[model samples]
Target: MRALALLWGCLALRASAALTCPKEMSGFEGDTVTLRCTYESELRTHPKYWCREVGVFISRCSSKIFSGENSQDVMEGRVSIRDSPGELALVVSLRGLTLKDSGKYWCGAQRLGPDEACPVSLTVVPATAPEATAPEATAPDAAAASPPAGSSRPTTQPDSSSSAVGDPGPASSSHSSMPSVSIPTTRLLAPILVLLALLLAAGLIALSTHMLWGWRQALWAEDAQRGEKVHLPAAARREEEAPAQAPEAEETSAPCRSEEEEEEEEEEPDPAKFIAV
Candidate 1:
């Protein structure tokens, strides 16, 4: 039974070295980030070391420990280690985390009288959005309107004294009761409108350039075809005129070179009637 217990303890120690971190880790700035390292273990006095592995070097982390009363600078204050010391889970609190605090961390624990250790990966996520504030206009202006006295009204009017007179003017009462309303101007949005118009103009320009290029290409092709046709006829005419012999006279009569012409050549041999026989 004692041998069996020793074998079981050895198995548990081997299992504790297989501790791993969680798959998903997310936390906002100024929030707590828990590096979950779950493992199987039999010994509770073994100390686990958490380090940040950057590139090829491992740096020591000064965070809290689950050994009850032990804590470091990085692990002090709000920082805490899990209740189950054998589990090897760690929690680090960043009071006001900034962008520079993002990094990857790893946790490991060494066996007591042997050369064996386990490690797990950890991720630190910083906040994305900026802090919120009361919604207020960044730029406020109220000098667009002028009164009948040819002067701009003050942005804030002072409280008036008690008057012995009758009802105040409607314009005066209205202006005093209401907050100054600054009218929106087309000039304020001119840059955006101009940018939109320029984009449209650029599209039109590109389309026109494409159309003109296509038209020029078509016209060039047509001209090339016509020139080829003209050159072919001229070449044919030159070939046909290759066997030129002479420039004969322009005569209206037919040529006299056949035997029928010999009859015509020999004058009419008029013969008297053959009286004899």
Candidate 2:
């Protein structure tokens, strides 16, 4: 009887000493979650690993085990672990967690055997369910909050209409009849802009013509120097040959000559002063 009692106590101790884990952890699908298990400080150097719980029993780590040297670590496809060389802890990381990953799991240090494992329970929040709960409340709030614009319409618009009818109120009248009593802001500026554009175009055309005329003059001068006659355009030739009317030219130039020049021209030498010419 004494031996059986001692055996039962040891078995219970082993059962209770399985890997330690949280009561529950919540996660989202497609997110990473960590399941941390703390162990006896002396087990720090031992290999750490985790696996899915099977029938409430854990014998060894899963076939995909993560064990490395005391300072380094190991990883499997989606699961990884860290055995802190000094701390009494092992952090097991599950990457790309999915809805299917919610379940009971066990973690252990390799040297501690299956009976010394820790239990972890993971719960995933259904990512779709929150939208239904939150959006339902917000939709009514959004609709109710929309009539702010209509709130001022009753108090303000009638005053503007009264002013535009006969109240001699410039501000109110402008506000009420803006569409009908208006000139385009750009209307006056449009003709000025067109005139300026035309002036600029004419200036550019005159400059181009002047440059071409200068080039022709230079070529003609060069040809004349080389004893080659260069023909002028007909309009240019006619302009050079045409003279002002004689009477008009005399009238225009009469006052320009000095009195001394006219007097010298009128005093001709007498034939007797130049004897026997």
Candidate 3:
């Protein structure tokens, strides 16, 4: 019985030495963390797995989360496990850590007999808050210190009653006397320049329209004068031909009238001889 106990103790020590892992690990909320466990060379072909402890006793791999096949990576939810046979190490990664993720976990390897496991305690802490930044102070404008051109600086005299009651400090006086922020001259001039440009463009357009109307009216008047000049010569020629044609018509009518009078005299000439019969 004593020899059997010694052999069992040596085997337990060997198994403990074969599977080794960190005792504790920590990560911030919303952060990722990696845990590595080294194993003996003889167990390199064994399947490796990661699991979370469920009960208070921290049983070995009670809730398996990820299991690795051969040397390939296996992932379940936010936890992933990968076995590197060359390095004889099992790597497990947990991403997007939360406060509830802090607990006891186990890294284990499967064998024909009992599985070998190592316990790891994880602590997930809340992320730290960022510090507040104070606003920067702005220096007073140099231009505001001097009065503008063509303007007299206004002077203010403190009331005698107020001075007698309490003397105002320099800080208060300086703060109260600080000039209000004056708008930039460029900002004020921008709209004025735009308005002036618009007025100038309107004036130019009106002037052009008036000139076009005047040119069109002059063209119509010129056409009217040219038509009148063309008709005037033709009217004058017709008037001159009318007077010459009128004298010829008068001479032809006078010869006809003399012949008619001679016939009338010859027809009435035998009136004396007929009255004697």
Model 3 C-alpha RMSD vs. true structure (Å) is: 28.2
- After TM-score superposition, what is the CA distance of residue 102 in candidate 1 from its true location, in Å? 1.8
**Most TM-score-accurate candidate:** 3
Where does candidate 3 have its weakest 10-residue lDDT segment?
A: 130-139
Residue pairs with backbone atoms closer than 3 Å in model 2 (clashes): 18-117, 19-117, 19-118, 20-118
Compose the digit string of candidate 1's lDDT tens values, residues 167-272. Answer: 2243234433333221122334567788899999999999999999999999999999999999999999998776553233323233634657788758775455
Give the whole-model CA lDDT for all candidates, comma-separated: 0.43, 0.55, 0.66
Using TM-score as the yardstick, the better of models 1 and 2 is 2
| The 10-residue segment with the lowest total lDDT in model 1 | 141-150
Cα displacement (Å) at residue 35, model 3:
0.7
Candidate 3 lDDT tens digits, 1-277: 9666444323322235679998777655677788989999988887777877542211223456545566777888888888998999998888887777777777877776556777777766565332222132113322322222212223223333433456534322442353333123334567889999999999999999999999999999999999999999999999999999999999999999999999999888677788999
Clashes of each: 2, 4, 0
How close to the true structure is residue 134 of candidate 3, measured as C-alpha lDDT?
Answer: 19
- How far residue 156's Cα lies from its native spot in candidate 3, in Å, is 52
Task: Work out how many backbone clashes candidate 2 has.
Answer: 4
Best by lDDT: 3
Best of the two (2, 3) by TM-score: 3
